[model samples]
Target: MTHEITDELQGIKVLVTGGAGFIGSNLCEFLLNNNAIVHCLDNFATGHRENISSFLNHPNFTLFTGDIRNLTDCKNAVSSMDYVLHQAALGSVPRSINDPITTNEVNVSGFLNMLTATRDEGVKRFVYAASSSTYGDSTTLPKEEDIIGKPLSPYAITKYVNELYANIFHKVYGVDTIGLRYFNVFGRKQDPNGAYAAVIPKFVKQLIDHQSPVINGDGSFSRDFTYIDNVIEMNVKAMLSIHPDAANNVYNVAYGERTTLIELLGILKEELAQYDTAIKDIEIQFGPERVGDVPHSLASIDKAKSLLGYAPVFDIKKGLQASVDWYWEHLK
Candidate 1:
C-alpha cells in the first residue's frame, strides 16, 4: 500500500501526538517503517504504554511523555519536526457527553495549543485526525466535504472547531494544514476494554471471551468503517501533497462503502469462528440507542482521490480479517 510519495518520507522528522493510542500508534509504526524519524507525544490519559512499548527502543522513534493541554509540552513536541500528525484528542461522543468540559479542554483548547506550537515551530505541514462525527445531524448518504450539519455532541463540536482553527491558522499565519475527517476507523491496536471502545474491537474481544456482545440499536446502524492502513495512506499523502488546491482542506478518509451493525457482527463472528467454531453460536443483546449517535454514516472519498491520488486498498472484510488475526495472537 505504499504510495508514490514514499521517497519523500524517508528520514523526515514527524511528530505523532497521541502516538500511543490506536490510530496514533499505527501511524507511528507506518512512519517509522518508512524510515521517518518519529517522535511520539502522549500523556497516557487514554493511550496505553503497552501500545507503544514495542517501538520505544527503535532507533528512529522517540517518546515524549506530555499532555497536549500544556502549551509548553505542545511546543516541545512540535519543535524541529518536519510534519505534525496531530491525533491527540479525547474521542467518543458518550465520553464527551459524560465530561464535556474535559473533552473541550483537550479536544478544543489542546488543539489550539498544538496549532500555535506547530505555527511557531515552522513545521512544513500539519496533518490531523478529524472525525465523521463532524457530519453531525446531516442525513445525507455518502457525505461530501462541503455539506455538514450542526454537531450533535461535544466531541463533534471540538472536531469541527479544529477544522475552523486549522483554516484560520493557514489563512492568518501561513501554516499549511490538512484535516482528515475519518469515518468509523477500526483495526489492530484499537483498545477493546474501554467504555468508549469502538464496535469492531469491542465486539471482537467480547466474542473472543465468549461473551455476548450488546448492540445499541436494532443493529441496523451503518458506518463507513475505515481500516488503519487506508488512514495511514491518507496521512502520508496529505503530508506529501504538493497540489496547490490540497492544502488547508478537509477530506473524507474512508473506503466509500457502508456496512450495517448486524452485518458487521456477522462478519466478526464468522471470522472469529475460524479460530473457535463456538463463536458462531454467541447471541447478541440489544440496548437503548446511544445519545449523539447518528443513524447511518457513509463518506465520499472523491475529494481525497482527486486532490491527493488517494486509493484505499482495504475494505471492511479484509481489514476485519487482519484485525481478527492480530487479536487472535495478541489477546491470548
Candidate 2:
C-alpha cells in the first residue's frame, strides 16, 4: 500500500507525544521527511534520547523535554500545533500491574492533560495510540472495534478509558479525535533490552547473540503482530482523513492475521540464518504463562480500510524478515 504525501501536511505544525519512543519516533521521522514542522514531547521515562538523536538537528524537528503529567507542559507542547499525535503512556501489562498508581498517573491523568490542552489549543485533529489489549477477556478470533470485552489488566483499563474520554471530548467539547488500537507493533529503533521489552525484538536480540529465548507459554498463543511502517501509515491517514465518519472514532491498526509464538520463533530463526548459520541452532526454553495474558489475539481492520482507506503493506513473514535484518546489522 503506497501512501501519497499531501501538500497540506507540508509546513503544518504537529505535536507527537512520546516522540522519542518506538512508534512515536517513527511518526516524527516520517512527518519530518514530508516537510512537516514536527515538535516532539517526551519525558524519557520509557523513551530514549538515542532514538531522536539523529533528527535533533533537522531544521523541521524540535524536541520538548517534558512530562505529560504536568498540565503546563501539555499546554506548552500543544500550543500552536495543527494536530496532536498523543502516544505517551505506560505500555506494558506487567509494569502496570506492578505499579498501577504510576500507570494511572501517566496513562489516565496525562492523557486527560493532553486532551484538555488539545481542546483549548483548538488542534485540528487529535490522533492517539490505543492498544489491542483493550480487547481483553474476549475469545473472538478476529476482534472487531465494537466488540471489545471487559479489560483484564490495568494497562488495558487505562487504554479503554482513553477511548471513552476521546468520545466524550468529541461530543461535548467538539474536539476532533481518532484512536488507533495498535496490535503488537515491532520494527527498527524498538528497544530490545528492557525488562518489559516486546517479544519480537527481545527474541531477535537473543537470536543475534546466540542465546536461548524463553517463550512465556506452550507456544500456542498467537497475535496479530503488526509492523511499525503499517502503524505509521495509519497515523498519517488518520491525520489527513477528512471523512465525516473518520473522526471521533477508533480503528484497529494491524496486519489482520495471526501467528503463533512457535511460528514466530521459527520464522525469526530462518531469517537470521542468512546472517549467521549458527543462529539457527540456538535452543528455545519454555516458561509458565504470564499473568494477564490472553490465549490469542487477532484484529478485524475493515473499519480502518473502509473509513480511513488503511492498507497494511507488510505481512508477518515480510515484516519479521525486515526486523530481523535490522537487528542483525545494528545489534550484531
Task: Report the Cα lDDT for candidate 2.
Answer: 0.93
Name every residue pair that clashes in candidate 1.
none
Rate residue 13 of model 1 by lDDT.
99
My TM-score estimates for the predictions, one after another, are 0.98, 0.98
Q: In candidate 2, which residue pairs clash?
A: none
Tens-digit lDDT string for candidate 1 (20-128): 9999998888888778999999999999999888889999999999999999999988889999999999999999999999999999999999999999999999999
Model 1 misplaced stretches (Cα beyond 4 Å): 1-6
Q: Which ten residues in a row have the lowest lDDT in candidate 1?
A: 1-10
Q: Flag regions of model 2 displaced more than 4 Å.
A: 1-8
After aligning candidate 2 to the native by TM-score, how far in Å is the CA of 179 from where it should be? 0.6
Please state every model's RMSD to the true fold in angstroms.
Answer: 1.1, 1.1
User: Which candidate leads in lDDT?
Assistant: 1
